[model samples]
Target: MVNETPQVMTIAGTDSSGGAGMTADLNTFAAHGIYGANVVVSITAQNTQGVRQVQMITPDMVMAQLKAVADDLAIRAVKTGMLGDADTVHTVAKALQQFDFGPLILDPVMVAKGGAQLLSDAAVEAVRTALMPLATLITPNIPEAEVLTGMTIQTPDEIMAAADKLHAFGTQNILIKGGHGDAPVVMDYVRLTSGDHFWMKTTRFDTQRTHGTGDTISAAITAQLGLGLDLKSAIIAGKAYVDATIRDGILVGHGYGPLNHLAVVTAQNQPEVYDDI
Candidate 1:
């Protein structure tokens, strides 16, 4: 037997600006020391500015890519981002059932960072009915949580309620992110079926570089899962990584900026005298 890097696969859309979608997923996986494999589900004409258009990949193409990857790789963890429509969502769910893969981290990507509709209204049901149940953990930001759970989240308690509601949908765990607020402290609520709940609170970074943060967080958790970390630990690690990335993020373009996936570069480059040989 030979030692090989852990593999993580992402099924998501393509972000033309390279700040999100499959691009962000690959970067996050590489940063976490995992091999990233992906199947593009849609294409978005987007950037830090906004989304101008979207073109979804055909169901046949999605299925082919998934089959090609599943047949060839020992995928330790999987994450999903954007599914353009109900048919695509159904197709992805069907493929997952056929493959019988586990430990899926779902991002529930309905809209873009700049407020663009990525998924159609008709697809939400398909996602909830098909994909949500298959997820080991579903990571939903406040707005997405609102849509999925049909409750207006106004406070921390409401966030917990939203998590509970989402749990009723068959997902094993829920991470309701409260990062979209005017408050200084961002709160994230995680609920497990075992009656364990974690409230992770962090100081809000004072910046507009929120672009792709959700994708990064989802990918980070998936990578940790791929490396055999427990679900809670993976969530914690992923949250820390996302927070730090936001803290050290770059201000790019005229609109919302991007996360600093290269934050670990300096640490990786630090001298190891014995290893210099």
Candidate 2:
């Protein structure tokens, strides 16, 4: 007898409040019916209000966790989030290069929703130099995109320019998320390695429970990839999953609350897709 369930891994920090980071990633993976594995890089004492204290795991320990997971479970896809510092980033990147983890989804988590910096400035540079080249898909919000591309991203054209700059870093695909923008509709842009691009537009819900949105979406995509969906379809499905999770908000903490991962059980609002742009 053999197990055929899809298995996915999340390389990220832990949120004590269980609202974001590894917790959210596992929840999203479970919701998608995928087995979830994780390698903890840091720990944060945080809640919906803010991040209080952060303790980074040693690089050696991080490598041990990565090897332990890779040695046993047949991980089909992996996503990285909330890497604490430069050493940990380098360690994870090296381990990723050594292993055969199917698809690497880099979620370059920089600042927490509560104004806490999760990844150090030096680690950002490490990600650009090391992890970016290994990423199958890199998802960045406007601010992260600006930091990576060193350009102000205001208009759609600017987003395209930023994506081009990111693609030059060797990532096969890029998804510039528009959730941080002040628009009535959130337009997430996707640029594939084939030079095909598209925008996924969804109505911006006025809610404060979008804490783990980035992790959730990226985890959803990883799970889809583990289940053997094509990259484009997986991305579209991930967007839909996140849209439903945000639209159906859940009250958890005082400040930025967590998304309803179980919202997929209800109606899913599909994003309006615009391609060939």
Which prediction has the highest TM-score against the true structure?
Answer: 2
Q: Which residue window of length 10 is worst by lDDT in model 1? A: 268-277
Q: Per-residue lDDT of 141-207 in model 2, one digit per residue for the tens?
A: 9999999889999989999999999999888899999999567989999999987899998888999
Best by lDDT: 2
Q: TM-score for all predictions?
A: 0.93, 0.97
Q: Write the per-residue lDDT of candidate 1 for residues 1-277, one digit (tens) a residue.
A: 3326688899999888888888889999998988899999988888899998888889999999999988877888899998889999999999999884558999999888888888888899898899999999999999999999889989767887788889888999998887887798777888887777777777777888888989999999999999999988788888888877787777677788888887753332221111011
Clashes of 1: 0
Q: Candidate 1: deviation at residue 171, Å? A: 0.9
Model 1 earns a TM-score of: 0.93
**Candidate 2 local lDDT, residue 17:** 90
CA lDDT of every candidate: 0.85, 0.92
Clashing residue pairs found in predicted model 1: none
